[model samples]
Target: MKSSVRAVLGLAGGALAGLALMAASASAQTIAITDGRILTGSGIIENGTVIIRDGRIAAVGASVPVPAGAEVISAAGRVVAPGFVAVDSGLGGNEVSSQPEANDLRQSSNSISAAFDLSWGLDPWSITLPVARLGGVTRAIVVPSHPGSSGGHDHNHDFAGLGASGHHEPGLFAGQAAVIHLAEGTEIIVQPRVAMVAPFGNAGANVAGGARGALYTLLRETFAEVRLYARNRAAYDRGDVRALSLSRADLEALVPVVEGRMPLIVTVHKANDILMALRIAREENIRLILDGAEEGWMVADQIAAANVPVLLNALANLPGSFERRASSLENAARLHAAGVLIAIKGNEGSVHRAREARYNAGNAVAHGLPYEAGIAALTVNPARIFGQQQRFGAIAPGLEADVVIWSGDPLEPLSQPVAIYIRGVAQPLYSRGLELRDRYRPGQQPGLPPAYRN
Candidate 1:
């Protein structure tokens, strides 16, 4: 967790490390990873050995004994920590957004089905998956595009021209999000549906008659319809269900949201909108998580008071719209200082840069957030927010062995992982990008330069 400290990664002939890199798939033998600085999220332990057996962490501490017949992997001089989690990633569903054939999921729809699941489109062997693991990211939340992003649509800029545009398509909701492991092979999804995604702020206002009041009314009415539909299931079967704007499938998909089983993640900015979202959550007794709150620093106290978490792109410091005029590099620091829970998210697309979660944390640290807090934002905060903390976010005994051994301070882009594990099993170090790098080297017949040699 100490970004200033230089980690020593002795990896000339790490036999166990080599074994881990080459044969990181499932194995019958016990695994012991020793001699590394372990970041347990809750705290840190220096020179720790984490024992793993049967896909879970068995023991983790500085002096924990390595079990008999364990395949020992020495992580001497490396940073051992829980693998990073990139929330709201668009990985596995597509390799490139512009390419029609490479991508599987659809985008830019006016009213996408709320039941549209991303797990079915996941390409488990995506070329980007291994590279994400190479960057020390073991877990990710794959999400379809949010309908409210300001990238593709016209900004509803006539509202006093503060740069906020309340322009959005009518009834556009992103599909459900899924949690997946970055390990090789198949069965990528661990949780098929973690949250119900929707829009708020200017985007929602655009969709709901160009005003915040109307937007809130629409959301309330939608929830009421979902409730009525759930209560009168037999009536719906008999064609007696009340008329609703959303289809039955989409309404059914939202059942968990109202029942408090799944959270509703809304993309919103502006201080007033954030407060209004909180008020709606309170009134409905529903779980909520706010995303893209560029002006969140203005309402940090209110967020902490509500016990709601915020997900954001830590690198977002510029005012892209009127609603986000208060955006700054210190936003993350300000929120954390006020006791607000914060999680860092990454860019979402067919070619995902979600692995940049650590680098984004580094940026937050550079702007005043504590280094440990930055690490927590990438590791445990999202897991805690998304209800996956018991298994995916820590290096504790009985937790899933999704750990990483870093060559240096993980926040630094120059550094990389020497070994990676998901569910107690080491992952292969190879990636299609690295293979292309080797294949396209400048020199073949003779050595042109060290950088270009075969």
Candidate 2:
């Protein structure tokens, strides 16, 4: 009897495994997008074809032959572009702002600083991810926030710590940021520890001491300690090295930054603070990406000269603080005009509002940014910024097949995606909200409850 039961169970397991393999094979099938207004890295193709095979773009041009038995998706009379990339997103971490346990974007009671990786507890199954994906955001750079940061889901808010909480220990650095594909599955992390986030300007000042000078001094000292710890790890482990402000794990995390292997994303808004961050990057010989640079337009020439990219909310125009007194809606346009690489965030990096980023890009175009550059800001620019240009930035050959076919102009507020593909696999545009709307809509069957109607 035992042998008979085991045989039945074995057959069932094998059948399940075979089904999984079949599903994967279907996802990897060749798909050809035909006759679309293709947006490529080089330029736009009025009528072109993109052939996707095995989860990668096989060929893209004006005339590409589709393979036999390949799935044909007609994008005629539509705009076909690379999926949008949302930077400094809180997705996969902050599901609900009110649910503290659900929000993994900040570690309020932790001893670690730079070593606090956001990818450790990322929840790829978060309901908010599908909504963002529905808005054509196939990729995102998920960043952790400081303990005392405000503005709810907004990444443009101040990233300052409350400084020495009695209940918990907070560190100078917020944490590491990660890049993730907004596709379904547990393995969503494209790159972990892509950048080290540090508070700068007012936020840094509050965390370090009461002044900006103290903040810079503390950073230099901390970096120096990182070098020392890296050079004499054995001695430090033996307690023979000098005492350091940050923990050993933090030092290890910053080694990549100090060694120029990773970029340090500093949250600074003021023009002078932006220059200071630039100077520090130059002095320390580290790569820099400015985040929340609300006043970056004021010193656009300097930022352009340094070739540092600026990430900001395109709609940030009001003087929210003294640092952003010179904020303007044209900040993105001016920065792009000054020859600086810029990535615009919509809804201030709100996870639930990520779809608004395309609208923000449209607004940027309305405020003097070129139309082509606006699209680049959402797609190729962010990918290049984080060293994923060859992986999935553009609708180019050999890149991951992350494409979006829009019903109309993608930048327009009324435009929507008719079909979306991520890594060659078609994704459903449905979300929990849409499900509820359909379930509880008028004219639904009255015999069953809304939950049972579906």
Candidate 3:
């Protein structure tokens, strides 16, 4: 009886091991995309064929031979380009508001806190992901919105809230912003905080007592404090009298921005605000990227001279306020023509509205932005600005295969991405919006009753 029991136990263990091996072997299959109008970004391929293997582009040319036994995605008569990279987007997770528990993009009144990582706030399977993916946006820089004071003790007597650069409920004294891939598995998609955000507009003035002079003074003083902290690091560490008790978190966060290693993405739109931001960048020798440059055309020459880039919203043609009077569909084109590198961003509120990206590019093209240049604004330019140009932003050998096969000219409003490959794997094209459309359309099968469907 004992011998028989031992034999049975051994057989069970062997079966378990066999099952594990089979599961491991059943990995995602490889595919090859071929015969299409490939926009390599560096140039164009009229009859191009791209070979994808192991989730990367193996070869890309007019005559790349297709491999036997590999799945072939024929792209004849279609447009193929690198998946779009949105330089700034808010699609990864929810943007929480007044309710602290509901928000993950800003903190309250804590100072000296650069340890906040945006990945912690990321929801990998957000319903918005597929909407953006199917529309050709494969990656984005998820940024935190400006924090508002929640009746807490103000950090500076004049300022009501601390504004750090992160993607969660950061205290007004929060730290840097992290780059995130808009895909499953958050761990595999994190790039450490690459920049620290600083607000500089009417909002800044309001927080600084409605005086532009006071606002500038506060900014300068903050930098001075950071400089002092850097100089007396050792003394501060050793608790010496010479060491200041100023918590270095805010100052420390500015180190990368001040050193020009990371950019200061200032959120400003008016001409005065743009000038002030440009002056700050020059004075500090920090790289600057202007976000929401609604009136950027007014200062195009100055921006070009400074070699600064602008992130603009293509659809914000209407003038919502005096500061945005110069906003137009042609602003991006004018900036590009004046030698200012321009990247198009979506509305700050919805990052998954990528279906409008190509349309935005089309509008710019119609307004005199070169067609290819407009395409680059949505693809390669953003990737270059975010430091992923080599692997993303283009279709080429040795690059990650984040290719989008479109049904027609990508810039046309009617065009749609038939298939999207992220890291060489075709992602599911379904989105919550599409599911709702199918369920509610006049004649479609009723998966659920009216109330539940709606």
lDDT of each: 0.76, 0.80, 0.67
TM-score of each: 0.88, 0.90, 0.82
lDDT of 3 by residue, 383-417 (tens): 77767777777888888878877778888877776
TM-score of structure candidate 3: 0.82
lDDT of 1 by residue, 171-279 (tens): 5466688888887777888888888777788777766677888878878987898899889989988989756666677789988888899898888989989999999
lDDT of 3: 0.67
TM-score of 1: 0.88
Best by TM-score: 2
Clashing pairs in 2: none
Which regions of candidate 3 fall more than 4 Å away from where they truly are?
1-30, 67-69, 95-101, 112-116, 147-175, 186-188, 241-246, 439-454
Tell me the RMSD of model 3 versus the true structure.
10.1
Model 3 residue 65 CA deviation in Å: 3.1
| Top candidate, metric lDDT | 2
Candidate no. 2 TM-score: 0.90
